[model samples]
Target chain A: MKIRGYDKENEEIKLAMTPMIDIVFQLLVFFIMTYKVTTMEGDYNIRMPSAAAEPTLTEETLEDFLEVRLQADPETRFLQTIEVNYGADRQVWNRSAFPVRPAPGEDLTAAQLQQNRDSRKVFASLNQFVINIVGSGSSDPGSGSEIEAEIDADPALRYEDTVYSIEAISGYKDDQKRIVKLIEKIKFRDTTNQSP
Target chain B: MRFRRKRNEILEGDLTPMIDMTFQLIAFFMLVINFSEVELSEEINLPMSELARPPEEAPPFKITLNLKEDGSIKYYDQLIAGIDVIKPILVREIRQANSDGVATSDVVVIIRADMDARTGDVQRLMNKCKAEQLENFSLRVIERLR
Candidate 1:
């Protein structure tokens, strides 16, 4: 019995690299096209129950809370002032008081560019003031957790300013690059337009 | 001058390295690509905060409401006209959450308001959520690292 000789020419089996390469390239292009660079995001948790459902607080408990009032400019809707009331003691930070001062050679436009920086500085001051009152969360964790903050923002104030205020009251980084938390319990004052 | 005879030879270049690099890139993109973009709206410019840090653990249930600069609310891809119109939507979400065995209070309502949006509108949105008995809220902000 003579065995059929194996076909010599059919021995070399080459994979079709063209189709795989094409598909791979297509996938790469798809991913590259859909890729987007997004900045890191975070959240500030707040618990606000309805007025009807809210538990009645005693006068002593109310006194323990901090009231933050954010006043806005009527026309421009810019933050005009921030006021923090801790019982009878009150602290106010005025935007106009901290005017943006440019360098000697800087022009108006250049100085105006530092407006945001000035706002940040104002918020930083707020953080400092809050630290003085509640003591740094790192130094005294009990006080920070016990004290709640009630944010009463103007109707027309920019949300950004409100966030900055919250950030100021929330925490601050220390010299050691550690986050020193302040007040964690934050609630918004109900300001729904009663009329219209 | 003698003409050289043409030979039928298949020339191949080594594609192993190129294929390897392509696969690596694909893997990286797959790992890094965020599938939660549906909950975030590009139209809203989030406020920056140094104290804001991403939560250590994601909430069991979340309702993301994107407040545009014009006071309009964006729920997923749908553009809500105003804050008042969002009550029904909240009701629907709460009902859905209830069906999923999640309590109304346990559901986290994430407010992603634009930096320029009015504070009053944000409060109103919060109030509306409160009226629905959904108290938990998370205000989304950009994490500013100094």
Candidate 2:
């Protein structure tokens, strides 16, 4: 009887609570460290633009993303003015239209100038280019060839066309940078349209 | 026949250890259950896209828009409701979210609208979102693979 009782005592089951507590604390710490706490405060009436994407930023913050703002078109529903902007590094981009055309009777070198001029006139409506601001004169056609329009792109300009435009420009190849020191607006974005 | 005696005849099966594990499993399932089926029965179909990817994480807030095939807007799974009801709910949600520590830019409002959804409907929603001061968002579409 004494031997049987000893065996029964050995059989009584027990679970160490220490390991369970350790695991719980480990999970709690993991959740806290990986947690991204942010606040969402905005108008609920705005149905946000949805894509299959989670709007990502590779090397920048939401504040640093390029903006192409779209307000309700001030004119007809058919037309919308897009204001484009990139932040600090080149906040003030300048625009200029240099009409380099194929020289009438020239060989390769002169023809290249014509090709270059014919290709596109650079223009900017940004705040950073000192050259466009400092180089104006009577001899230099009063700045319309490359107009320097003011740019105040809204932070909310994260729409398709606007985002596409910014990505096209900001992500543009630097090989073209030397030739594109001046920025040019291909067409004037009409800002005078009446509110929709 | 002569009676046969076997020492193995007194065998017993233990139930406590198995019972303890079963209870742990049941507790786990209870804690892991997601009970919200609020948007599944909308009768509205979300558009499927080839480029769709899985969501980042569950947002503390969201706005579900059900788009009718002919470009009509539905509110809260109800068809063609007033825009007035839509505005305050959105504003209040944003306000409530602010108190909950989610910034306007951090909140993601997922639009589960149909693909044939009108450009105007999409643009109007963007405008409303801007008015609400909510900045960050993404569209929800069905995964082609699914």
Candidate 3:
């Protein structure tokens, strides 16, 4: 017999990949099946104490607050006008003043585009007017903090309009995409018994 | 003369690149997947706000109430018909919070109302929560992208 080491040819050992590949595919399928796309949401905070717990407000305290009145149409329940009262100063903005533009990439008919701008203009104007009175919070923090915005909306007004008004009064985003706080305190003037 | 047959040659295609790509895809999907989507309701179309910003951190104890256009309240997949019906639920929630050592004022009540819903209904819902001593409220809205 010759030497065993020199006589035997080298053999290749193969590892099984089918099982590993199957498991990896299964994991991929599971994740794909459970995948979901959700939109981003944010919140506007409000502290609403019950009417019974609310403290009595003096005339001076009432004068310090900014009153925003939202009036809606009786039949359509559409916002018709916005009346902003600051002490004795008052301004009224009509719903038809500002035209609502279609959202980015949104397709709309001419009639829909022409439809009353809802509360968009009044809110924008309200924001600007507030800025004029309170000054930019980014520049001066104390003034904005001291003022409270009391939203007095019509009972039948669409909730969306009320939200839009709140968003306008609360704050605005700067060019840098940072929020500049305006009026932090907001409350709804009880409209439970009020009619449209 | 003696003839020997040669064994058929085995050929294997390279699978390493394919496996690498598949793993990358799975990692991407895992990173982007949202598991907390159950709290959001698809039926209520939230109004968009340009100034609304997502909170830096979620509140510890929070309840979400979805208000539909027809004045129905959706709470954790349960459809409540009117505001009056939600009072009992609010009481139970407050009791649960109190048992957990959390004050009612500390708990946040998130309201996601439909764009077309009446403002009166939303106020009524808030009133019910107020009756339960839940003072903190959050009006949830979609972030309008510029």
TM-scores of the candidates in the order shown = 0.89, 0.36, 0.84
Please, what are the lDDT tens digits per residue for candidate 3 over residues A1-196? 7777764446655779889889989989989998876668999999887777887888978766899998988877777888999888899988773335578999766666555444366677988888876773236753356678898888788898888889888877778877777888898876545433
Per-residue lDDT for B1-146 in model 1, tens only? 23343344566888999999999999888787777887788888898887788989988888999999998999988999999899889999999999999999999999999998999889888878888999999999998866
Report i-RMS for every model: 1.3, 12.5, 2.1
Candidate 1 per-residue lDDT, tens place, A27-139, comes to 98888887889988999999887777777888978866889999998877878888889878898988863334457996657457577567667788788877877763246
Ranking by DockQ: 1, 3, 2
DockQ of each: 0.78, 0.07, 0.65
**What is each predicted model's overall lDDT from 0 to 1?**
0.84, 0.42, 0.82
* Models ranked on lDDT: 1, 3, 2
Please list all clashing residue pairs in model 1, or write none if there are none.
none
Each prediction's number of clashing residue pairs: 0, 42, 0
TM-score of predicted chain B, candidate 1? 0.93
Candidate 2 runs further than 4 Å off: A1-196, B1-34, B70-85
Candidate 2 local lDDT, residue B126: 50
Model 3 clash pairs are none
